[model samples]
Target: MNAIAAPAAADDNGLETGLNATLREPISADGTPVLGKTYTVPARHGRAVRVKAGQTIRIANPHGTQVCDTWIFNAEHLNEFLSFEHTRAYIDRIIPQPGDPLVTNHRRPIAELVADTSPGVHDTLMAACDLYRYRNLGVEGYHDNCADNLRLALKAIGLRTREVPQPFNLWMNIPVKPDYSVEWLPPVSKAGDYVDIKAAIDCVVVMSACPQDIIPINALNPLDVEFTVLDPAVSSHS
Candidate 1:
């Protein structure tokens, strides 16, 4: 592994790596923030960050309660999108673990999970919050949702709503009960909990600071989250 260009990745520590039960944190060192900037996504808004090949983006729940609905795309190819179905097909488990690649529709790996500190509670089965969903749920009026936020954020890059693919809910806790039905649950991620993904190829990452207040997904409230893009090329090995 190119330690100078790529931090410890999933290939270095396999998915079976366990987290300390008392306190979970980032997989590898936070490293030096060199290549990109850190963006604070305020509540009810979305943001996009682009990174080159081999860079790592760390999405963190600073408050430990907010969920970030995230989507990925190949910067050069619009047709290829993030496909949870294919990702599930590649792994034996539904929830991502360290070393799992977030694959594109063609099964191309764009990002791989290098480390996570939230007790492995993420949801790949649910769709982003949308107005239609709110309306169906008997919401009184228009409400903020992750879907629209994602579209608004992607617009800056010339992608339309149709191209905004399904998201990977980071730090979300949606569990399936024994009845085979799913239920929204509060996240277990504490403050400073984060998940790091090493970009295998150049890709655009879109995230909604999840405005899901109607459910317990965000603990019935929405808050801000933090995004950090780490350039391993300038980082020193420990």
Candidate 2:
């Protein structure tokens, strides 16, 4: 009888999960935000904030060329997040427009796109970049990525999610060609352009200033973006 060999184990990276500056710089100890105050998500970093139901979050593109990967999760349930696949099915489009309901995996509305000051071009097709992606891109060491940013952002607020769902890639311009090929391009939004998303339930919103300098998705440079949780009583969109 011949002995069978076991399957090879996968390669292991040295970094610990949720280990980064993000954990030390949460918007608040519990992810709650001060109403009407704008916070900056530094380049190559992520930030998480709590937006209560009926509150609107305005994400601003300060440089207009950077891509901010955005995610929303139910405060009570980290697993219940704004799913792009479910949202695409709900909205019947690839990019959501103002007034479209962003849905969750269970087909429930989690948030609504209230207003967009840009041309309304956002990508819902790409997965958040991870360390493995950077490895494939010939990066020899650990690189800051959106997937870990999501994890670190949640962990910063004493929460965790087993899965990283596709994000609503704000200002990420990936255009499909006539032959169905896609082109990774920079955002068309101008400086100070913003979008407002109103929460249907209390939720934690995470945004990462994507650090994909190798590709031109961020015009070969990543920059900080800004966000503010609006005062529901005074917000015009409320």
Candidate 3:
């Protein structure tokens, strides 16, 4: 009888044979995502995106010092979303470091912080700025805010404001005082600084280029932010 050969363990690119297994594509220069495909989240505005598992979403502050309030939702289950309380409890820290997975309200991993070029300054304490908060701050008339931006972002993705949950404030600088109090401050990230995350599950990514000018969280200047979703598994990207 002829002996049978074992199943090939490597593919053309030498990656593991299975798609759900470890990925082979490596990220360099933040994947240098296609420009035309890039979406700009204008200052004080928000945008929604659909990122698949193993793909990455890179948020860049080209002009620098801007805060991008971020939120994530499970694509399969609308009711389950990224939760600040869960993240804090799991990570045991208000802020997460590279390699830390961002969890959902149901305690499922949705995304992970994969890369960071900035000082990794961010906030998870204060809630996204809303109309009510601004009014109390002495602001008059209608104005842009993170809360509204989140609603708009959700709408773009066929969701509602009610689905919006606590966001991970990317690049925000809120210093936790010795007394356990935190103070809003300008971001330590400079121009070209960015952070990239790999989605652990299919997720809807939401972002609001924070419109907050009441404090120095954005250096008192709101700037445009760049959002790019890259699929490392795609050979063309390599």
TM-score of each: 0.81, 0.92, 0.81
For residues 1-238, what per-residue lDDT tens digits would candidate 1 score against the true structure? 1011111244321111111110111212221233656667777777766767888888889999999998887777756768898899877689889989889899878889888877989999988877667778887555666766665565544444344466899988888989999888889899989888888887777778888788788898899998888757654212
Angstrom error at residue 40, model 1:
0.8
Number of the top TM-score candidate: 2
Q: What's the C-alpha lDDT at position 26 in model 2?
A: 94
Candidate 2 collision pairs:
none
| Model 2: lowest-lDDT 10 consecutive positions | 1-10
> Distance (Å) between predicted and true CA of 24, model 1?
35
Q: Which 10 consecutive residues of model 1 have the lowest summed lDDT?
A: 14-23
- How close is each model in CA RMSD to the real structure? 13.2, 6.6, 16.5
- Judge candidate 2 against the unseen true structure and give its global Cα lDDT, from 0 to 1: 0.87
lDDT of each: 0.72, 0.87, 0.73
Off by more than 4 A, model 3: 1-36, 233-238
lDDT of 2 by residue, 37-86 (tens): 98999898899999889889999999989899999999998878999989
